[model samples]
Target: MLIDLSSNENPYAPSCKVAEAAIQGLEGMNRYVEPEELHMLRKALGEYCGVGTERILPGPGTGYLLERVLCGLAVGRELVVLNPAFLSCLDLAARLCKRIVRLQLKPPSFEVDWTLPASGPALVILESPNNPTGQCLISREALKSLLKNEDCLVLIDEAGYEYAGKTFMDLIPDHPNLALCRTLDKAFGLAGLRVSWLVCGDAFMKALHMENVCLCRPALRAALAALEEQRAVLEEVKGVIEERERLKAALSQLGLEVFPSEANYLLVRSPRPDLGLLLRKRGILIADLSGQWFSGYFRISIGRPEEHQALATAVEDILRTEEGFMD
Candidate 1:
């Protein structure tokens, strides 16, 4: 069987309670999710996030919720984003926003300067522990400075918050212009269920209507079950982090430059761009970041130990063959 490690997903299956909850939800497939059930999910999420239920706005997925936020807040405003952000978010911004100011994050560290234009209305979108690079781009002080500007609105995607062990949700109470998009898809192993929510400040709450934010029955059940099993989620995140370090070390030993990551994947650079192709030939699929943003760089999601071993072995074989061919 082919080993797929391209998507940053939880390698382990979700807790037994989550599965049973989903199965139970299937019994009422015909009816839409009740308001009380949705409220329960939001209440559970609020408790998980340390915010009030009034601040939570549930949605089908992060991407969808992001689109809504952009459409509602981005028109006629200057859109500021990182160079290598979530691709879908970039694409959506490109289409919706008239003016986009992209802040490029250079390599080795992939750090952002956190400098915005002195004045004017702008919507700044940031992904903490940014995708592909897997590094947290902004600090609390820097974010606070931006929040001080009344005309500036900030939207942050914290999809990898569970792995990164950091968050800006606490700032929401004081900053009306700040909003956060979070999801159960990443750490909670609910990607297939498409469960996501927005922790909105007063401004966002006023702009976007909450009545339209509804989730399917199974998704609602699954997310609620997953939240209840936070202990299991913590254990899973610990395992992924350990595996990530091991995989990073293995790749570095093979002479590939692996960047430090806070998420469940590693950003690696190879001498040749065909590194993805070489591994694909061995029935191992990893994300080839060459054409998307950079060349000779790839993202490998943390997976089972055996799957990682197979990837390392394939890379070694490829390198060995290349050395022989050069001779």
Candidate 2:
């Protein structure tokens, strides 16, 4: 096994029920599908997300949902984003040709500018439980500050929400300017299905141009089955959590600075960036995130036990090599 840890995904195979469900849905698949076919998904997600059906919507994945959220609100002005945020969010801002105001996340904690400027018709984007750094998510208090301003539209993409449960979805009704995007790729293990969703006030969904959102139904079907099929996904979730705790304990023993990780990955820095790259040459697939805000650093996903052990071994080998190099 190559042990693909590059994309943070649930390595466990999909439920047997999921395959049957997709096949059943396939009988009518040749026919044109209804947009309201999204209802079951919305209902299940609402139950999981604690948001109402009117407040939620689906997409091919979180990326498509995020694109629509930005397209609907993007006013051709500035879009404020955190630097070294997820790469796709950066690409979307560029595609929209929206002038970006990239801000470096300040230390003590990597946080965003909650009091973002009201200077232009700006759409603010950020990832909570943020991707590479594995830092703490922005709080509801921070969200309140942005929503209170009323001039900007705040979009929080919690792609790793499975690992970090904290979110601003409950406040959606209070802030029409607030839009939240979520995904099943991480939590539900339907990445192959490419499932994702969006939750906003009814007005936003009504105003949204939803043509592209319809194409994700095949994956959405698997996603829905995952939700309704009796806690099938939860077992894998529990496994990942257990492995995460185990990995944390092992990495801590090595004395590397493992930053607080709310997601499936750990943020680890070295005395020099070379160490991250050196481990990579050994056929290990951990993330090496050096010189991009988190220079001299890398991230490794919380994988299955066997994979975790192999990575830990590679890391130990690297450390022993480094000690020899120094001596």
Candidate 3:
């Protein structure tokens, strides 16, 4: 059986309500998606996020919303980005922003340099439990300091929110410059549905002019159903977190250096760089970060216990074969 764990997705099935809503929404596929339906979606999302309904803008995916946010806010400004962020942010900044100033994260720990440039950039992009490294970059105090600049617009991507269980959403009401991007894809098991949102300040809401960013009718239904059954969805997130710890311990026991992660994935440094290929041959997929800044590391999405055991067995076989070659 193929166990694909490259992308960090929730392993659990979505609630029955989500499935029911998806089937129910199909009946209206012939008609154009109405405005009121989307408005209600934003309202429900607002409640879930604990922000004003007016501040939430929904799009097909977090990347789409990220593109729009960059286009709307960072187009003519100096963009300060933390390095080794989601690859798309790096790609978009180079293309869209007038000037890009990348701040390097301190090595080993991968903690961000909280010391802002003397003249802050107009935009700053941050990711919590960042991809690849799976480390949270800033502390609450550092975040407060960053927001104090007032001129800098901070876009914090909390895509791995459920696993981390810590959020700065409460900081939104006070900081006009702060915006948080969230999606149903990661923790809610709604990747196929493609619903995401940006929670921002009044100025951003006004800046975007309340554009009706298109989310398909069926996807909207799925998103709403997912929200209604958030408790169950969160329980799944808890399960992933628990399994992540167990997997980390197991990998460590096998002599792989596993990096700390607050997200639903682990950054593992394999002794053999070709380990990903060997595993892929056995129908087990993990993210090879060797091509990225992390030259010897790969990211493993948290899977069920059986998948982890399969991976461990494969690793042992590879090590034994390699030891024979050495002898």
TM values, all candidates: 0.95, 0.89, 0.93
List the candidates ranked by lDDT, beginning with the highest: 1, 3, 2
Task: List the candidate 2 regions with Cα displacement exceeding 4 Å.
Answer: 95-98, 106-108, 210-212, 230-232, 322-327
Give candidate 3 regions above 4 Å deviation.
Answer: 117-120, 323-327
* lDDT by residue for model 1 (79-99), tens: 988876564666778887778
- 1 against 2, candidate with superior TM-score: 1
**How does model 1 score by TM-score?**
0.95
Best candidate, lDDT-wise?
1
Per-residue lDDT of model 3, residues 1-327, tens digit only: 789889987777687789889888888789988888999999999999988898999999988887888878777677877665554655777787778877765447776676766364578877787876777778889989888887788888888988898899999988888899899998888898888999987556766756567888889999999999889878887888889999999888887889889998998888777888888998999988766455557889998889989988887777667643323
lDDT of candidate 3 at residue 243, scale 0 to 100: 90
- Could you tell me the TM-score of candidate 2? 0.89
For candidate 2, write residues 1-327 as lDDT tens digits: 466666788777677888777667777666766767767777787787888877777777777776776667665757887776565655766767457787786543776666665376777777777877666557777778767766677777887776775777778887878878888788677777787777775446555853335644466677778878536566666677778878888876775667777787777766646665666676667666655676666777877888878877877777766653443
Off by over 4 Å in 1: 89-91, 117-119, 323-327
| Residue pairs that clash (backbone atoms under 3 angstroms), model 3 | none
User: Largest TM-score belongs to which candidate?
Assistant: 1
Whole-model lDDT per candidate: 0.86, 0.71, 0.82
